[model samples]
Target: MTDSADTLRARLTEAGRVCGGWCTVHIDFSEDRENPEGLAESRRRSVRDRLNRMGADDATVAAIEDALSTPSGLPSPFSRFLLARDGEVAVDEAVPGAARGETLEVGVLPRLAPLIATGVDEFPYLVVRTSRDGGDVAVHRTGAFFPESTASVEGRTDTLHKVKGGGWAQLNQQEHVEELWKQNQQELSAEVDRLVREVRPRLLVVSGDVKARRLLLDAVGQAARSIAVELDANTRSDGTDAARLDAFVAEQVAAVEQRDRADALDLLRSRVSQERAAADVGLREVVGALQQAQVDTLFVDVAALDGETLLALDGVPWVARPGDETGDAEAVGEVPAAEAILRAALLTDARILTATQQATGAGAAALLRWPAASVTGA
Candidate 1:
């Protein structure tokens, strides 16, 4: 029921706490261009059949179908995600990292680990292809089905062509043209600056003329320049090399995530050495910390949770492992380890981070809100 991005994770996991189970789905609309709708229904029907075989109740099956019934009309190369309970959906929207095929799950918790592992950014961003005359900008946001906005920032066009000869007059004209290019960049950058402030984009990607990019860097003020990454592209709308541009975009995006992970790992290492450390290492330990609503950040390889289950109880101290409990929390059966951890993290408002590299020897780690000993005075 929450609409704020700040509390989305919490909203998702709150449903997990009271819901008996979930029906999760990720359907890629682009994989079958010929019959996208049909493909989606086929996949849904398969899950429908499976659920029916399992003797799932009518309400749960209907909830799953109703959730999946809404199709995203976004363009190709996009995917959608849905998570439903007995008769209501908690999460339903478009997302990045298009699955190669239909992925459906009926489980103990909402299947959100795979999506989180895709490094979904929760903020808006701008991608621009600029030239000396103007820039083409596309605004993108997390879970947005398509580019949220687009703008063409054009300035004076008369000064774009450069002079080739070397006479005093030509040299003067060349200087004039260079100055005009700067003016054009200033105009484009001003629009970009406005957009950045309005949307508070997490990053800005500018690609086009080298000279224009330099001018943009100079003109854009601190806020925009701080997150701007100049792509080595010589495109300006027309005749854009689609393949090359996609490759560059993917590479830059991956690089940004890598830098973020590096910083997190460094902090994790530094914190772990302290006497009253606010960090937990290993999947089991992290899960234990999550039960206390103590996790501030979680680091893990999503792959590690595959085919693995975690011991959990139905109520307080929701997570546990063998030889690790002594209370009256009733057993809730084995739950998917990844979903359990993800659910706990979400419920407790913890940041879920996919550790692309090794975080610890145990395939998972977390920076807790407090030291382990402080949690429930264990």
Candidate 2:
């Protein structure tokens, strides 16, 4: 429900590390067509039984139920993710996508890879559906959990008409109408500039009345203009073809993600080829860098870690192979490899980029702030 990334970061970072006694739930609470009310109860009962078997206390179960019952901020057909520790809801999210399936795990490090896969947003965009006088702006925030925010600019209809059948007197009224249009465009442009600054969206999608589109684009600052894109699917002044607008937005966002993903991969390969060790591939090296907070971004292939297990320590670099935990950690336990690595990445403030198993051979890799040799003493 919260719009702030800082809030989620602060809550998770506060945990530092916890090996067990945590309940992580990722499930679809979207309205069930067959039996909406019953589905909710069924999902809850299934989780409650599992957690009870795992020795979850009453508070933990209550916290989980409260989060599930709460309404989501995200649009419909989205899944809900809740992470609870010490009888408190630590992380709660409404991810915008169809649920793959239900996942309920307890006594493990929070299963965060799925959360990252679904909740993480990178390519922010703004869709401006404009008209002669003003327009509606849908702002997609950068790297946001809840991505949708809205604003609108409506101009007075009194002087919206252009030149009509008239004499010189009416010609003066036409001039007034043109002036009003310019004024409205300017006002809308100023608001767009403000939103661009606040959201820092990667794309400014402009649509609607062609004339207003041009005028608003012209009125906006140079920076917004640079990224502004014009779309032609305007059904009417008051509304747009929703499906077409949605598809275009999806296409634009996908293109950006593909470009960025390629750029990241290329950079990793180049750093490795050049022998900078600025990039570390596989678990041992990446985990080593992460321990010291050296990772700038962590690339993880969740498929590679599917059904895999890892040992976790209480603090400092937090991960170890099974049977290796006894050396340092005062508290240690076995947890999902994907969860442990992702948790470490988040705690160290490293950005996570989910990769396919084909791209990353191991469960994890990292682009580091410093050379790996420094950490490994090679």
lDDT of 2 by residue, 1-378 (tens): 444544555555555465667787888777735787688778778878888887887899988887776655445677877888778887776666667877787765676766777535445688888888778887774435344778888887786887668799899999889888878888889989998898788888888877888889989998899888888877337455867877787777777777777888888878877656788988777767776788988888877877887766687667766545344554366777777787778778887788876775567878888887776544
What number of clashing residue pairs does each candidate have, in the order they appear? 0, 0
Question: lDDT, candidate 2, residue 266?
Answer: 81
Q: Write the per-residue lDDT of candidate 1 for residues 1-378, one digit (tens) a residue.
A: 123344345555666676457777776645446676788788678777887776666787787776666655555676666677766767766655567556677766566765666554465778888888877788876555446789987888885778898889999888889888989888888889999889888778888878888888899989998988877778785746655765676666666667877887888999999998889888878877877788988887767667777765666677677777727776666776776677667666778787743555456789888888795644
Evaluate all candidate structures by whole-model CA lDDT and list the values in order.
0.73, 0.75
Cα error, residue 250 of model 1, in Å, equals 1.5
**Model 2 misses residue 24 by how many Å?**
0.6
lDDT of 1 at 301: 72
Number of the top candidate by TM-score? 2
Best by lDDT: 2
Please give the lDDT score at residue 72 for candidate 2.
52
Whole-model lDDT, model 1:
0.73
